[model samples]
Target: MKWSMRIVMTLTISLVIAVCLSLLPKMDSSIGINSPYHWPSNRIGQVTDNNLPDLLVQVPLQMRIRKVELSSTRMSLDLSLPKNADSTSVYRDLYTIAQTMLMKTKNVNQVWVRVIDYSGVSDNASTQLVLAMVAERESGKDMDKSASELSLIQLEQELQNRFRITYTSKWQQRYPL
Candidate 1:
């Protein structure tokens, strides 16, 4: 009888330990601690109302666009105009393009443009442009993308053509949002 009691106690203790180990992960998730089921840092979330930067990179441009920043209500662009191009005309064209592209959706209210002139600056001199674009958030529906995704080759070509500036160049933090 004592041997039987000892066997029964050992089984109960093992079962209790197994149940507790199984419940540990669930308890961690419920309490908002580090959980195994949580999303990894590299995993992209759903395309929500905050994916303006992704959209900006897809916009077609004639000149070399350095940087783009967008928010729920405002958008900004930094462009490096060619030495031969007219700065005023380039600015007007870029501003119009940005305004039209962004204002088509009800979410954006304003667009800002900054033209960076890298004509005579020394190799060590800074050529970063400073500009800010800010707008109040509006309650509106998101924009729809009916077009299919571009191929890797097409994307690479677009990047090579659009971004003439090197990746090591410094860019100003212009957008407030």
Candidate 2:
């Protein structure tokens, strides 16, 4: 009887551990909330934060960046993704990356992101624009601003307030946003 009780307790503990282990990767705490869509980093350009000023860049787990530009009020990035990235997920990835950039540098009022086919870059004017978007910050003129760390929920709310991106595919984007 004593051995059977110990066996049952051990089995219960083992089951609990198994269930917890299985859920760890799916937990929201591992990455930011809704943060699963950045592109793969092994494609074309390996990006670093050398050129960006007043901002620090963190490429989300799988994404690679080709070029980045920062101006007085805007941040622009040319991201490289898998050649076969899914169409539906492409926009989501771009949007999430854009939001991440904005969250990282709360001072910037705009972020422009695009994916261009690296193989076609010899013809700079004609590179295919797979997917592109621009997200502009929308803060109430009346609200007080501070340098506190931005929460993921706040980032989502900020994206919900951006102006519509009407003309994004002009790939050689010159910025003065």
Query: Whole-model Cα lDDT per candidate?
Result: 0.47, 0.52
Superposition TM-score, candidate 1 onto the true structure: 0.36
lDDT per residue, candidate 2, 66-112, as tens digits? Answer: 78787777778786655555433444455565545544444567778
**Each model's TM-score?**
0.36, 0.44
- List residue ranges in candidate 2 displaced over 4 A: 1-57, 61-63, 120-126, 139-163, 166-177
Question: Candidate 1, after superposition: displacement of residue 52 in Å?
Answer: 4.4
Best by lDDT: 2
Candidate 1 lDDT by residue in tens digits, 26-86: 8977865333233223332222234444444454555676766766555566677565654
Q: Residue pairs in steric clash, candidate 1?
A: none
- Misplaced by over 4 Å in model 1 are 1-60, 87-92, 120-125, 128-177
